[model samples]
Target chain A: MMRLVLGLVVGVMMIGQVAQAQNQPLRLEITEGVIEPLPFAVPNFVPANAAAAELSSDLARVVAADLIGTGLFREIPSSAYISQITDFGAPVQFADWKAINAQALVTGSISVSGNRVTVGFRVWDVFSDKEMKPGLQFSGTKEGWRRMAHKVADAVYSRITGEGGYFDSRVVFVSESGPKNQRRKRLAIMDYDGANVQYLTDSSAIVLAPRFSPTGDRVLYTSYESGFPRIYVLDVGKVQRRVLESQEGTMSFAPRFSPDGQKVVYSLSQGGNTDLYLMTISNGQSKRLTSTPSIETAPSFSPDGSQIVFESDRSGSPQIYVMATSGGEAKRISFGNGRYGTPVWSPRGDMIAFTKQNKGRFHIGVMRANGSEERLLTASFLDEGPTWSPNGRVIMFMRETQGASGRSSLYSVDISGRNLRPVQTPDGGSDPAWSPLQK
Target chain B: MNLVSKLIAGCALMALAACNNPTDGTDGGPIDPNAGTTSPGLIGDQTSPSYFQQAIGDRVLFTVDQSTINSEAQSILQAQANWLLANTDYNATIEGHADEQGTREYNLALGARRANAAREFLISKGIAGNRLKTVSYGKERPIEICSEESCYAKNRRAVTVLLGGLAG
Candidate 1:
């Protein structure tokens, strides 16, 4: 098996002098309100060998982009730097970085040995003049420098934010083109940063909601190949797929993988009524989860796999509900005025991201697992399908324009309801499902 | 499409009665049959698909997030059922669609419910279940592009598209 990446035990560790400037550890956690973004600096990663020269700056750029994109950290322009970092072991001139209002500093090195490359990086608390995190290194193929850079960025982000890193992840979504009425859709995968996009299915078949497996190797999606919406699973790397549902009369869609990745939960429409069903991926055996006459779909499993949260119209209008994985009476969690759907359990297991429609406008919002503390993160003409980032700190969703010339595109927002930004895609994108950080 | 094309298509259906008739209707007035034979369209031609579209109505509108058949929808479905019985060879693929107002999955389910609502209405009127198929495009397909309620009401619709060759 070709493992794409592996972490290496650094033979040489830079043990800093551990300067004392502040009592509290360096962190960028902001609660309840917006503040100025923390300013940081990333000098170009130094190429340790001649072979790594051309790609060193590119590596540093990706790291900087990942950190800046979060809206939590701002990069102090290199032009404003008083001192330049040329080596990984060079001690951080805290006074110089502090003079430029830099709270954190990052230094990295790229060493190439044939097709294999090793990347080592360190984060420094510029104010304290102490190491923010222990030095570490990642080794991978030269062609995968981007992933290596992402890994570095992930480490830096996590060390400062005290949260899991989402940079080293992928998103499976439907790439759309043409007009709103006659749209052409295909299954496409891309890096979380919208880089290295690769198509998984041709536009001949209409595809939607390409959700990633827990392991991030396979994807579950809905397609209209047989002139009916059906669930399908595709091996992302191989670009091979097969129909997961083949019932004669029923049409299935809105599929998701269980937390264990052993079973699938999807909605099956039979005789005009929709309900949720669980199917074992190994044996293709099925079990009915809900027997509701109302529309029951968009099932997402909790991180613990003990329960499933889904949207159902059993309460008259569509509302978020929580029921056991084994099935029973679902407790309605959303009691607000608007209709709520697409409730996704956050990976952190504390929040559920969802889509809401009220007063002709749509919103992406989050609430506690029990539906308390409802917070709308974004509102737009048409915003739907909230997908949590791997860290559960951000939510990505599709926003579509109105009319025949209208189109759909992806946007994301921090869970705090700040920093709403568009996620760039080559073509229109919708139904984004973010994968867990890649192994 | 742009405002010009949207206006033309809306005018063709007479849905936007405010638009001026191309056949020299004075200042946004109704079309005159005497001005041009084609201007009358195939509304009176009962045997044609255009007749089904322009007269009997091949589509029905639903209120925001509703699948229940309203009174007007019931009347139209009655006409549709009578037409289907008269035109025995026709089968329809009921395309259910939602406005850009809901989640993709829920809108898809909503569309399904709307399509099935129409299908059940037809079946109640003695149409065969095998002769009807349903698909929901959710918010993916919108006939009207405006973000306002005017266009949203039109986009929230279920259209019964006729297939001529298949005589099931």
Candidate 2:
């Protein structure tokens, strides 16, 4: 009897140890340095009506592209799926997704009526065998089908990752056509995926460096229509533009709207010297923020509008510098080995995205606001003009091909410096200015 | 000191003689006496004399981040004016360009200012303002495409393109 009791006790203890070992949180052991992209599957969305079949496919594709563009998620190709989703509300077959090694699944449906488009989507965790959150739905014009899809993607991304979504944003860029020597460029805005493009200005005269306001309603750019370089603000809704401040003989460019949209910060060249200046939009009054003889341009406001980051050649080579909005002795923040230009502060306020030129090659890179941990994300013959996605998880910039046959195109990469892909456009593109997410 | 002063005086006397010599006949002549030598003269002789008997040096270079002309540019302008004077019937379009090192819009503005500086210099040198047109190519038309100082030096120049030279 004693031997039986002893044996039973030992067996019970052994079974308990095995159960604890099996349930040890699965030993996720996610390494902090590896920066692996999250894996998710985006299946084709079902159309509520036969007329929406095409739109449903397009919507799903755009959403997947946007999410994958962030480099945070690796899209599991629909070809890998063993099952089809006929309804969004139907329970997902977790076993099927697990078999294909998709940790997350996104399913949705699209309904179109007249000019209206309604989309509904849900994100599920296959491993947990549970819906991550309640279903999300949005409605808009048929023309806004892409945007509705973006919103749905954003919701799923946010719910699963516990971060904001950037898909529902817009991008304003300079559209280029014609020959390289005399390229005709105009300001253009489109959906984040390069759809629904609209030309904001005719190529009557040269326009450069178009920047969107934080609210995404106004654009600030420099135009040669006046036969000189001067700043102009255009209301996106009205398409009417007015000179922000007209100073004769002095050149002003690289204009950025303040976070509050009250002032514009830009570079002004006088007597052959370029410096930065801040101009109050309401009063048309301006103040010279930097008096250095160095070429100071590409001024970007911090997310809180308390500081400004700009590129300057005062350090002998072009580098990024940060200063208080009120203006004072600026501190050098970039210690990289190459020349840096177009230092744009990220919307997230923690990093500054810049274009670095080194060893006859150009790279798009990001670094902390303090100028440490500089990481070169992409390197090529010519890569420049990085614009951050609204959530700051992705960066879209222009990359030009090599040699005489070079063509420029837009590319997006995640903050981790992964998942670089070219954004599709009708023609070549550059100077992407991402808009704020639409409410 | 005395010898130097005497040499300077002798040179001044010779200069005065040259200015006053009516027989020299080089001071003034038929502005278009050779018009018949060229095709309809609307396209004037490849070489023709006119009120503006000078060629404005078609190009000016700017220092980095600067559109201001230096003393070297001023000396070049003196020669440019002579060229413009010889081709008075011609109007010119001054094109300003910049190196690719700068921002596109800023370079455009800088290029304009650089071109304007040349225009102002030509006007100061007795060229009619209406005869000179100004445009900025910014960093678009780089004579040299290499990303080096040697190439950039050639790029940061304002070029004067001659238009409608010396009508009969």
The numbered model that scores best in DockQ is: 1
For A1-439, candidate 2 gives per-residue lDDT tens digits of 0010001112112111111221112112222255567788888888889878988678888888777766667888888889998866556787799898887788887778887777777666777666654566676777667777777778767876677888877888888876554567789988888788889999877787789988988999988788556789999988999988678646677899999999999987765567889999999999999997567888999999999999887877778999999999899999868788899999989999999988778889999999999999998878888999887878999887654355778998876776788887777788899999876
lDDT of candidate 1 over B54-155, digit per residue (tens): 677878999988888999999888877776665554667788889876678888888998999999999999889887888887877677766678988988
Poorly placed runs, candidate 1 (over 4 Å): A1-5, A14-23, B1-51, B164-168
CAPRI grade of model 2: incorrect
Candidate 1: true interface contacts recovered? 0.71
> Chain A alone, TM-score for each of the models?
0.97, 0.88
Model 1, CA-based lDDT = 0.83
Question: What's the count of clashing pairs in each model shown?
Answer: 2, 15
